[model samples]
Target: MTRTRVPALGAEGWFTLDAETPALLGDRCTACGSYAFPPAGSFCRNPRCASTAFATVPLSRRGKVWSYTDAQYAPPSPYVAPQEGHVPFCIAAVELAEEGLVVLGQVVAGVTVDDLQVGTEVEVVLDTLFSDEDHDHLIWKWRPVAAGGAG
Candidate 1:
């Protein structure tokens, strides 16, 4: 039996799960060039800019680690743990160079706080959040970029 895939969190247009390289979807102000994650619609997020037009944009997949920490406790609602219960996980805030924005996500399974450092290069990858009999929920995660290799 195969389990269907789903987004663990109900965010539409936030990221793509079907691309060769998974990328976070963002909205860029056509007028001010400001970018926002979760793809802002209907308005420019830049306060100084009065334009409401936006273009859907794929965010940079690679970034430098800005900060990181371990989540030892189960997260609050909207996050569901597996049947085994809460497992410690590392979360990282990565700074995208072009956008100059920091996006937070969990590090790939098996990654830990000790395995990361500020300025370490990382790349976005799709990962399973949890699985049920009917579906395997997916989410974006960060992984250390292999040395001298493209992400």
Candidate 2:
């Protein structure tokens, strides 16, 4: 049976799934040229800039790992564990090459904290966060750029 793919609710405008490559949709300040993910709206996040105008732009795909950790405990409600139950997952803070901003996300499955190090090159990709009978809920994940980099 075929399942429909959908972004995890609340992730609609935060990323693009139509491109040859998946990209996070960020916003560039029209006045001071600053950038923010989750698309900074209403006002520029830059404290020095008072501009409220922004242009939606695709963010860079590659970055270097800034920090990482593992979630050994399952989160509270609203989070759905897989069929295998609550397994630990790695989380990484990656500094986007062009934006100079560190964005946090879950590392791809099968990768452990021991496999990552600060400065490790990584890239963003869309992955299934969870699956229901009719849909595959998706979200962005970080993966090491090198071959066999996952642990």
Candidate 3:
């Protein structure tokens, strides 16, 4: 049996999976150079800038851990829980250097609180969220940067 891969949630153009290197996508205000993830549909988020034009840009693949926590309970609707019930998972907020913004996402599987710390470097990677007999949902996740460097 073969399982089809799909995005766990609705497509919002926040990231691209078809590219050779998957990357989180963002929008940059042409005027102020401010960036926003999930791609800002209109207007610059910078209060000082009046420009509404933006260009799609790929966000930094690497970042430093700003904070982290574990979810011990199942999340609310739209988030499909595992068939076995809630499983605690680590979540991390990483600060991107060039983007100058913090992005939050789930840490890759097998990573625990003991394996991370503030200032630890991490990189984005694709991982399976959950799967039914016919489909496997893929989602972006963060993993600790290896000793050799970014992977």
Candidate 4:
């Protein structure tokens, strides 16, 4: 499911992994042709230029696993683990083409640590981190990529 509200940091547009919207989000520097995810809220990190105006750019959904690990124990405050049962979640860092940067997120449903390895191939997937009675916090996650021959 895609998040409906506009992103708060760099991009003014909302994010989604729905078939209709299957791109990661980043801010493109109008000054330079660089992009940053989670939107570079502060300023462009590129050392070569000093520009402020940023445009929302769609990122590639598929990437190769740069590295991975799992949270053996529940994370502390701010991370609200489900109350019903403690489920260990796998998080991965994926490296995209052209960007040369690594994006980190959780593995999707039906995936586990046992299924992951460094340099594995992965694709971005949108999933809910949690939902209260009122709203759901949607986030981008990674999973084994089908085309990469992941098994």
Candidate 5:
């Protein structure tokens, strides 16, 4: 049986999956130039800017680690553990310098907090978060930037 590749239901409109280099989709406030993730809302989030227009845009694919930690325990409801059961993973808070935004994501599989540092550079990548008989639920993850700047 073939399983379909699909983004997690809650993540729709937050990213693009078909591009060679997939990117997170965000919305920039037309008035203030500030960006927001998940791309939802009719008005700008900036308190000083009253303008309501925004344009969907792709966010930076790379950023520096602002912080990171190990998740030794499984998450609560709505999170499905892998077939082998819960395995420890690392979570990172990466700061996109261009947007001045910090995004949180799981570290790519096989990488642990021991391999990362506060300022380590990382890039976004898509991977299976979990799977069902019919689908592989994909989600964004962070991986240390390879030498020479390739993601």
Candidate 6:
């Protein structure tokens, strides 16, 4: 199936992981060579650093699950949840070792609250959150990658 939703590519001419290629985009500090995922728009988020300089970088697709939880209830408004028949979903914080950062996102299709456990290794994927009468929103997701293989 093809998804029409187009997510926010990036803040300023940088590329984001979306359909066909799901990868986290980030920034690297020129001074200390530290990486920042989700691309710090204004300045470096590093506590010890005091520089605004950064360069675009792509994160590894594969990561280990740092933590996770299921949403038994629908998230509050402005969240864009389903209008009726609310269903529980899972969210996870994945740790990319190459970037040394944790990115939180939704789980991939066929993955449920029962199918997940802490510390499971997963790979990133692009998925659609929901499409209403007005818009279709694409978002990053993750699923268990096959052993020794990219998902």
Best by TM-score: 5
Candidate-wise lDDT, in order: 0.85, 0.86, 0.83, 0.72, 0.85, 0.72
Give all TM-scores, in the order shown. 0.89, 0.90, 0.86, 0.81, 0.92, 0.80
Off by over 4 Å in 3: 18-20, 147-151
Q: Summing lDDT over every window of 10 consecutive residues in candidate 4, give the lowest-scoring window.
A: 5-14
RMSD of 6: 3.7
Q: Which ten residues in a row have the lowest lDDT in candidate 5?
A: 142-151
The collision pairs in model 1 are none
TM-score of 2: 0.90
lDDT of 6 by residue, 79-106 (tens): 7664476677788899888788898888
**Between candidates 2 and 4, which one is better according to TM-score?**
2
**Of candidates 4 and 3, the better by TM-score:** 3
Error of 3 at 127 (Å): 1.7
TM-score of 6: 0.80
Worst ten-residue run, lDDT, model 6?
8-17
Residue-wise lDDT of candidate 3 within 43-148, one digit each (tens)?
Answer: 8878899998999998999999999998888888788765677778899999999999899999876778988999999988776777888988778888898632
lDDT of 6 at 39: 77
User: Arrange candidates by lDDT, highest first: which order?
Assistant: 2, 5, 1, 3, 6, 4
What residue runs in model 4 are displaced by over 4 Å at the alpha carbon?
Answer: 1-14, 17-21, 147-151
Model 2 ranges with Cα > 4 A deviation:
148-151
Q: List the residue pairs that clash in candidate 2.
A: none
Deviation in Å, model 6, residue 88 alpha carbon: 1.1
Q: List candidate 5 segments past 4 Å from native.
A: 147-151
